[model samples]
Target: MKNKALYTLLIILVQSLHTTALNAQRSTPTEQINPYRIVERCTLHGISLLNNLDTYLSGYNYTGAGYYFNHENLRNAHTGNYNWKYLTTFSATLGYTKQQSNSQFTLLASRYWSGYHPFRVSNRLQLWTGAQIQLAGGALYVPANGNNMVSVKMRTALAATGIAIYRLPVRQHTIDLRYRIDIPLAGIMFSPEFGQSYYEIFGLGNTHGVIKFAHPLNSPSWQHTLSADIPIGNNTLRIAYTANLYQSKVNSLRTHIYNHSFAIGFAKTIYKIKRKDSMKAYSPLL
Candidate 1:
């Protein structure tokens, strides 16, 4: 009789504890929900027409087709009481010249900090002036010439850029017009001496004073971009015309590249979402 009574007591105790646990769980919440905010990024890709002039070989000029890609991140901040904006751009180009039957590739990256100021001229016209620093590097190749088959170009410059923007409100849509120009003021470039053998520079590594500090007289470059952005739903179609003029004179050899291209691309804004309160716990029950 005593054993039976103890067994019965243990069973009742376990049942009571399990019911209490169930009640506690029901009273508490199951899961928590957190809100997230998004940050946007933009990218552009297009095609280009390349024009290259090499003075090394009897003033050879060639025209060809190429491609262009650009990436940008824009942020708005406050500097003291003034509004400030920052834009960083990375662009690349690749082309093939028909006459020389050669290929060239160039890459550029720049950052700008501007003060946002908008004034009215008929409609609202936005003007932005900013200081930019850009680094550029590229290579040009030519065949059938054993002495100098390749020309290596490398440069870094501090530049100033101006941007003019106007947006037109179409019927249930919008068109944006933008024009931007970048002019490099001063920088440095690496160029071999006229008739200098690459074997002496690369193989023997006689690289003293090969890098010259470039001013307006030695190196001058300008880049222009005019683009129109047409919005359709959540995507934007971009049509742009770009022109670049780059010239350098070092060691008595004059080299310049004139490149112009028309590009059609798509621009899309992407976002990254971050949870507001990741650590907070929420109730599953309504």
Candidate 2:
């Protein structure tokens, strides 16, 4: 009887230990999962020097100073994705130019959406190649010309874009040096034929040759941006120089718009937290 009781006690003790072990394992926490997305947003303001020439409106080059505004948002393509990112940007400019006694006022705006795949070259350098779709519209108005005082601009293009970022350690912080470029491949644009007036196209309903297909051969355009991000206290200060060259020869008419600008901006990063349902659905086995 004593031996039987001892055996039963041992079995009971073993079962207790097993239950304790399982309880401890269940109580231990799993590795924390990140439930937030990081996003970068920036806004910039600057002064642009504009040079414009449109054979439909004027034969002389018009040049002047303009105000420029730019806004951008950048984020990863998806949760837990480090190889790809997405960016969206909007920019606008307003200015005027004069040649002799003729004055031309211009307004321009463009929006771009892009996706990039990053190639890490080193610990300090990264190269990103991307593609973008751009939508642009603007108008140039000259008061001196009658019946054809306004030249409207509208275009959409698919562009090849690239960015290079280099990190430089300075004291206790790092400064990012970046360069970006964009070249349009092909798209469509709205243009009136040579010697065609808006009255003839809109009022008189002569709409032929108003919409044209564009390619590198007919509309060769590119943009360049060089920028630096400097950390200041709790904020990042961005200083940039941007140059845009746009040219097109279509419908027997020639047009070009060139702008160079120095810009100042602030960049900030924010985290977007997952919702309660998302958090619950992401539970993992411990």
User: Best lDDT goes to which candidate?
Assistant: 2
Q: Which predicted model would earn the best TM-score?
A: 2
Query: What TM-score, computed on C-alpha atoms, does each candidate reach?
Result: 0.74, 0.82
Q: Mind giving the per-residue lDDT tens digits that candidate 2 earns over 1-286?
A: 9999999999999989877866665455343534336789889999999999999998889999899898988887754545587989899899988888789998999999989898999999999999999999999999999988999999999999999999999998999999999898999999999988899999999999899988889999999989899999999999988898889999888999998988899999975655653444343332
Flag regions of model 1 displaced more than 4 Å. 1-40, 100-123, 270-286
Summarize candidate 1's per-residue lDDT along 130-149 as a digit string, tens digits: 77777877777766557777
lDDT of 1: 0.69
User: How many clashing residue pairs, candidate 2?
Assistant: 0
How high is the CA lDDT of each candidate model?
0.69, 0.89
